[model samples]
Target: MSQSQLVELDEAAVLGHAGQALAHVYFPTDCLISLLTHRVQPRSFEVGQLGYEGMLGAAAALGVSASAFDAVVTGAGRAWQIELPHLRALTRASRSLTLLMTRFLYFELSQMGALAACAHFHTLEQRLARFLLMSVDRLRVADLKITHEALSLILGVRRASVTLAAGAFQEQGWIQYSRGHMLVLSRAGLLQVVCACYRQDLSTYDQVMLGSTAAQ
Candidate 1:
């Protein structure tokens, strides 16, 4: 087994390179990481997000050696690292941990399904609102350092569309944007504008992680 270490990552840092077998699993303590699918056009769409509630190298737990998504740090956070061998051993020995991680995996799959439907059926404005709500929930913070270009890639839309949607939000006083930073001003208003998928995903996470005691 390899030694356990705590790693601190800065924003936009690569947690795992594409096509590389995960050598270590990372349990995020204060950081948020995004798992994105890189495309031929050099575009990327976020497929999953990991925070203090989950670990980064989840594919390895399911017996997959390689990752399809590029794992990048979306926020500054701390992660406890354990080598692959140690992680495997721990998972084998602990049924509780295995069940807990399985629950997270199920939630992740549901989130992906929700995102796929959202991409197909929802408008850019609705999708953007949903994205903001999800980010706020994961970071538990109001301010987000993101740009229209970044949002465009994540939403699989044109930069112009992102700009327009963001403008609408700003005009309504739902958010304050300056430079590349966005501060959510009206959480309730944002939620009202977002589609139902956001709440559905949140409910799944709450039920899986916190049971009936989860916050609404």
Candidate 2:
């Protein structure tokens, strides 16, 4: 922990490119990092997210050196970063730390699976709601500095689709959007609009990561 340094992440900053070797692990204090899976250049979708509640480079901590997805900073804020080798050495020195990291890795994989299923089976509105809800929960801010174009990239949809859904949300007084900013007006309304997968994702994290932390 003492070796870790506090760093500020700018929005859209690429932390680690896909298939590259990871050099550091980041634990966000308020930032949001998206793990993007790519099909082609400029065509990628978010598979997982890390924030204050989670750490990037779980695979590295678990002994995998290569990154499977690109890690991009979605929300600009601060985080604690440590060298990969240093983190791995600390894990080797502590059994409880190893267990906690193992559980976090499981939680991350579970989220990816759940989100993939949600993308295939759920409506765009529901998925959008889920994304916004998750973003706010992670960033602890209602006014998100994002645009419809950015939302489309994250949700793997056309920009027009995101515009349509966001328009509807604004009409319903559930949110307000202008330029590149979006303010969530009603969490309850979003809860009603989001799919069951949101709750399931939260439950999985609570059971896996939180339970591990508690046991430790």
The Cα RMSD in angstroms, rounded to one decimal, for candidate 2 relative to the true structure is: 1.3
Model 2: how far is 57 from its true place, Å?
A: 0.5
lDDT of each: 0.80, 0.90
RMSD of 1: 3.1
The digit string of per-residue lDDT tens for model 1 on 1-216 reads 347788888877786877888887888887788777764485667777777778887668766788777888777767888888788778889887777777787887787778878888988888889888878777778898777877877788889988889999999999999888889999988988899988888788888778933442
Against the true structure, whose TM-score is highest?
2
TM-score of 2: 0.96
How high is each candidate's TM-score? 0.88, 0.96
lDDT of 2 by residue, 1-216 (tens): 889999999988889988888889999999999998854766678889888999999889879978989888888999999999999999999998888888898999999998888889999999999999999999999999887877888888889999999999999999999989999999999999999988998999988877757875
Model 2, runs deviating above 4 Å: 39-42
